[model samples]
Target chain A: MGDTFRDEELLADVICRLIGDVRHVAVGAQSPIPATAALLAQARGGGSPYVSLLGSRAHTFFTDGARELFDCAGQGRVDVFFLSGGQIDSEGNINLVSVGDYAHPKARFPGSFGSAYLYYVVPKVILFRTEHSRRTLVPKVDFVSAPGGSPGNVYRSGGPIGLVTNRCLFDFDRARRRFRLASVHPGHGVAEVIDNTGFDFDRPTHVPVTPAPSAETLALLRTTVAPMLAEVYPEFVKRVFNVPAPSP
Target chain B: MPLIAQSLDEALAPIAGGRLLAVPRESSGVAMAATRALIRRGIKRLHLVTLPTSSLQADLLIGAGCIETLETSAVSLGEFGPAPRFVAAILSGAIKMRDATCPALHAQLQAAEKGVPFMPLRGLLGSDVLAHRPDWKTIDNPFGNNDPIVLLPALTPDVALFHAPMADRAGNVFIGTQRELVVMAHAAQRTIVTVEKIHDGDLLRDPRLAAGTLAGFYVEAIAVSPRGAWPLPLPDHYGIDAAHMAEYARLAATPEGFAQYLDRYVYEKRAA
Candidate 1:
């Protein structure tokens, strides 16, 4: 693989791999990268995995409205879902609500959407945060929109499987309630990740660099996935893939 | 009796200051034009509910001080960024917030649609959203030992409001594939709709359109407001106005800027 792909492409490639061979992948709003990955995965798998972009009419199949997504997840229909947060702790707890006190937050993020429920139902929840820094990877999230792990008695079929950031990927251990350094993205190192991280995590002594997207994968992303993504994330596609915005 | 209103203001007349108003998510045809009208009217103390989630509609209402309390899953501007006005209001504690998850809000309204006292839902265990909502109670599954589930009280809003592509003279709204509006209409005491145009024939008269049409019986009022979901997409009919939305996100970032936005768009209404 050459150094031709952009960071967004790299992140999308990583998320596609994280998505694995799933039956249904639901990408939420404000998530261009995950939506790209889901489309890419769908294209690559000969359309085996159904991709549902929440806000797109062309991408989604549901006619039952917004509740259908959650209802389907509850019935164990959705296999992979993506969630991002304002802050994510080592324990995989995500905070999409606020950064400070519940009553008077210093910085209030968009209120929690489906994470509270989808995080519990979707079997593979891949956490993605484009920004990798101490502020974002906090020691403890100010609010837990959804816990990374529930108690033994809780009826949880899904939780965080791994986290993909701009710098690296961290695989979550649900039973141990911790994260292990999986692999660092190209141009980033363990030292850089450690320096920027606020919470502690276990990392292998020899952390390999994340592989870049294959030329074939890049071609598929640019030619196929880029057009499909334009339906939902036109601006992102215009910026990352240089796809021209359709005439209004 | 004719249910059509002569004007947007008259259509929104039933939406009193303190009444609970239910609205659909952005993709389901948000009543952006009506929202501006509400702001222009200086409607106050509205308890706004977003069926699953919201974006510009909620932010604009919150910024205009029309909202007293907001009950929703999330409020964002999609690709544009975090809703500046909504974030500021939350940080300042200007309006009461009842933070809820997407499914919970849907279930609450579904309970009302079914005329049930409450609806039992899975998930939301060990979440702060559930913790903060004391009104939401957890009861053990009597059918199973040691299994507890959360029961959400039925949420019957005073009015349900939205925009759509078309409605018939008889008040039958053609909501297309956006079925959430149906749930919202079914749960609310009265349904108010704004459409791009009035269809020639009854929406229910067409077999192809009947499945997606909300019966005229549920709709209390209808107003013709072309491009009613402006800046936001109305699915099928129009795409989002990217430049306008980007401009809105930039201009609405500050209080003075937001006021400027209100002056240019809300106060001085654009000629439809």
Candidate 2:
């Protein structure tokens, strides 16, 4: 508690590494972490893995308008995308629709945005949820906004590749249709993750700690990435990084 | 001759009760002032269709008891938290929800725009969303053996209502890069637009803005409402009024609070 915790920056670094060597990563609205990671990747890779942030004029490259983003994804131009939900299960089913019956839900979350389509079209759909607690990571989602994997006969080219939470990271095994615990974050243990997680996942015999962000990465994030993110998510940058809001 | 309304009320009058009214996403110029005007006029029983998603506008309408059936991918006051009124109404079984995905809504509207009966789209094949939607159907591709896909029925709304950055005297509204609005205008039988301001010259005359302009031929009515999308951002023009949105989210959490909010902000308008 002495020094300010850079949890968001650390998570962003982890996400940046997970992005790998992709051509284009398109981040949807309301996803600041993934957007930061995409931008970080761009900065680290010398302008590689183009980032197309929805709802950003400088970041997006769509001339045909909002529909163009969908068209591009349909044509397989978008490689990596981000999706999250109110509840995520062991099998990677996400629920952004409702918490109870479809007719009369006990809790109604914002309806599924593009998960139905993006979860299938984007090659690498990284599911990110900041809170990885029992309530959020459930045994099974009440509503399947999008399934992690589809039957072999079904035409699905995209699904969950990995899930990043505040506690840890889990790599999705498409064939097994289960999440395998990759690593727990610093100051967090496997037991803590297991205790907090509502869903069951396979764990390695010896779990390792998620690597802390390097000094260079932290510096770059504070300087370069923060400003770039400010262009799109000014409030997030201000609240998270203490960056001044850019003048309109 | 285009149908240009003299006032905001006149522009919204054609959107009769229980009409399937299509509106743009929250990011693209939300007609907030027009929305308040609609609420003040007691517009009821609207089948509200948010192109892909919505925020305050949808929640306000739902809270005001104006929406009968809502078809959209999602509706939330982004960053502000969950849409309280939408959640309250849904929990109470007050409104019918035709749950949909983002691309599905856009694809259906495009199908209507192209004058087609239905449009085939990828995905939703294995999702439970398809299971609940009895209206949607899946079929094996006629050309390819054993290839299946989801076909969405065309969504031709009765009226396309939205706010634009500007509109010319000829009724052409300049939407800039928000192209989804163009699709909405084309798919709906009638298009009613509220603009922030009116352009002096014909919008079509400027070749640069022409491509981004929605020609007056598809427009049924237009009204000039400066700061039409107030409390909401107009995409590339201004940012969202976060304080006001936060206040709405806070007030809409409870039914009584929501009514009081409507009373202060919507019902009994104080002198501006």
TM-score to native of every candidate shown: 0.98, 0.97
Q: After superposition, how far is residue B132 of candidate 1 from its true place, in Å?
A: 0.7
lDDT of model 1, residue A99: 81
B1-272: candidate 2 lDDT, tens digit per residue: 45667888888888878999999887788888888988888889999999889999999999999999999888988778889999888898899999898889999999999999999989898787898899999999998878899999999999999989888888899999899999999999999998877899998988999999999999998988877887888887787777787788888989999999999999798212
| CA error at residue B168 for candidate 2, angstroms | 1.3
What DockQ does candidate 2 have relative to the true complex? 0.75
Stretches off by above 4 angstroms in model 2 are A1-5, A246-248, B270-272
DockQ values per model: 0.83, 0.75
lDDT of 2: 0.88
Interface RMSD of each: 0.9, 1.4
The regions of model 1 sitting more than 4 angstroms off are none
lDDT of 1 by residue, A1-248 (tens): 55488999999999999999879999887889999999999999998699899999999999988889999999999999999999999899999999878998899888889999999999999999999999999999999999999888788999999999999999999989899999999899899999999999998989988999999999999999998888788899999999977654
